[model samples]
Target: MISVLFAILTALSNGAASVLQRRAALAVPDTQTMRLSLIGHLLRQKVWLAGIGLVIVAAVCQAVALATGPISVVQPIFVIELPATLLLAGFVMRVRVPRGVWYGVAAVTVGLALGMASAAPGGGSTSVHGAVWVPALIVTGIFEAALITGAMSTRGNPRAALLGLAAACGYSLTAALMKDAMGRLDDGGVTALMTSWQLYATAAAGVGALFLLQNALQAGTLVAVQPMLTLGDALISILYGVTLFGEELRTGWWLLPELVALFLIALGCIELARSPLASGHAAPPRRSTRVT
Candidate 1:
């Protein structure tokens, strides 16, 4: 219950930060590309700094959540982020959230609850065997490399979706690394944690994830990016939780409910992604675009 609360807090912070940070980033001039100097300019934006603060808060909440709960439960709760962002953006932009968006949010909420209940018997430890990290790291690295390479080959929305998935993978890895580092604290106090390489790896994975997210935002609109980011992270995190942390989900007959739950989530995410207000869209003037 504590972990769930913290995870929910993290999701809320993340949703708000996504809107504020991405909006602030969009304010930067088109000439700025991927230059490090862009950091200086972004830092000057009050909105970006505020977003960064929220990000830090989210990180802290996430760490606590991971420390206390199975990764399977904690990470999947982040699926609410998309709907939260949608509603928050709607309020911030002073636009009425469409009825369809509310329905989408309901669907996602119900699906997440169903999925969590279905996966209720999941079991995992706070840490994995050191030997497990080797294969896990190698597989994750190769997968992220493939995603970035594929992203580079694509353009527009496709590029955004690929990059978003890459970011999702990186974030999931960061969570795993953090949990492993937290386990170090349990074994040998702060000294063990400070000495652990998992600590450094967590930071590195987090930075990599943020970089990919920024690139994804730059590559395409929120419509193309949000669902991929939301769904990909939840799905990938489950894989990491199960494979690396030994979390187990019920199978056989239970797989049916899980599949249905996932399908509803995917549907909800896609629907929410198309919301004009959440997407920072100007609410398409279709009649005008049609040469009226």
Candidate 2:
């Protein structure tokens, strides 16, 4: 229950962070795309700094959730971030969220509850053999590379979706590394935690995730990216939980409800993506000063 609470809080924090960070990123000059200098510029923005602070909070909450619960259980909860982001973005942009959007949000919330209840994921081993890391990393790395390449090769919404998918992969990998690091901490002391390769790997994956997130935000509308980000992370996290952490979800009779829940969630995502809250409007043009 504690882990579940933490996971929900993490989703809220991450959703707010995404909105704030994207707002700041959109304000940056277009010429800064894909450059390390982009980070330097964003660092100077107070809004971006606030977003980073929220990101740190979200990370801490996610770590606690992962330490206390199964990865399959914790990661799926993050899908709420999509609805949360839309709400936050609407508030920030001073746009009223339409009634239809609320219906979509309701679908997402209910679908998530039903899906989690039906699946009842449980029993995971955090400490896997070192040999497991090689194949897992290699396959994930290849997939992420493909996503990044696809993102860079396109423009507009397609590019944003691709980058968002890459970011999702990076975030899922980071969560796995974080779970391993927490397990190391439990087994060993502070020294072991500091020395664990998983700790450093988590940090690296986090940085990569942030990089992809910013790029995705710059590429197009949040509508184009958010669904891919949320769904990709959940699906990839499930895969990681099963393969790397030895977690289990109910099968057979439970599968029917799970499939239904997934359909509802997908329907909600489509509706939310089409909502006015997600299709952000352009800012009004600034008036020019005339010297007579």
Candidate 3:
């Protein structure tokens, strides 16, 4: 129950952070996309700094949740971040959320409850061998590189979705590494955490994810990016939980409920994407400066 509460807090923090950061990122010149100069510009924005602070808090909450509960359980709860983002955006943008949007949020909440209750994920290994980490990181890195390359070659919604997926991979890997690092901390204290490569790996992955996410936001509308980002993270996190950590979710008859949950989540995402709050945040691209 404590882990569940932490997971909810993580979702809230992450959702709020996304809106704040994206607002700041969109305010920057579009020419700064995928460039280090973008960070420099964002640093000038207080909203972006606040967003970074929330991200750090979210990371801490996520780590505690992963330490106390199975990844499958903790990760799924993060789907709430979508609705949370919409709600936060409504307040920040001063837009009214429609009745339909509220219905979607209710569906998502109820679906998650049903899914978590039915799936009842079980714990597995807290630590993994170096061999496991090596192959997993290699494969995920290759896939993320492919996604980024594809995104760079495109424009608009497609590019945003591809970059969002790449970011999702990075975020998922970061979560896994964070969990491993926390496990090491438990076993060997601060010294273990300092010595573990997982800690460094988590930080690297987190930076990469942030870069990709900022670019994704710059490339297109939240409607195009947010669902892919949320869904991809959840899917990859599930894979990490089951394959790397050896966690288990109920199968057989429970598969039906899982499918229903997925449907509800998808529907909710679609509805949220159509909300006035999300549309209002879809800023127009800044005019480029041309030099003779």
Among the numbered candidates, top lDDT falls to: 2
Which segments of model 2 are wrong by more than 4 Å?
Answer: 19-50, 91-94, 149-159, 217-221, 282-292
Per-candidate TM-score against the hidden true structure:
0.85, 0.81, 0.82
lDDT of the structure predicted as candidate 2: 0.87
lDDT of 3 by residue, 1-292 (tens): 8778999999999999988997897689889998999999999999999999999999889999988887878888998988898888777756667887898798888878887878888788887755898888788978988998999899999999999888888888888888888889778998998999999989998999999999999998877887788778877988899888999888899989988987787778778877766666443336699999
TM-score of decoy 1: 0.85
Q: Which numbered prediction scores highest in TM-score against the true structure?
A: 1
Question: Order the candidates by TM-score, highest first — what do you get?
Answer: 1, 3, 2
Predictions in order: lDDT: 0.87, 0.87, 0.85
lDDT of 2 by residue, 145-238 (tens): 8998888888999999999889999999999999888888677877877899999999999899989998998998877787788778888998
Predicted structure 3: lDDT: 0.85
Misplaced by over 4 Å in model 1 are 19-49, 282-292
Clashing pairs in 3: none
- Error in Å for residue 171 of model 1: 1.1
TM-score, cand. 3 vs. native: 0.82
Q: Which candidate would rank higher by TM-score, 1 or 3?
A: 1
> lDDT of model 3 at residue 12?
100
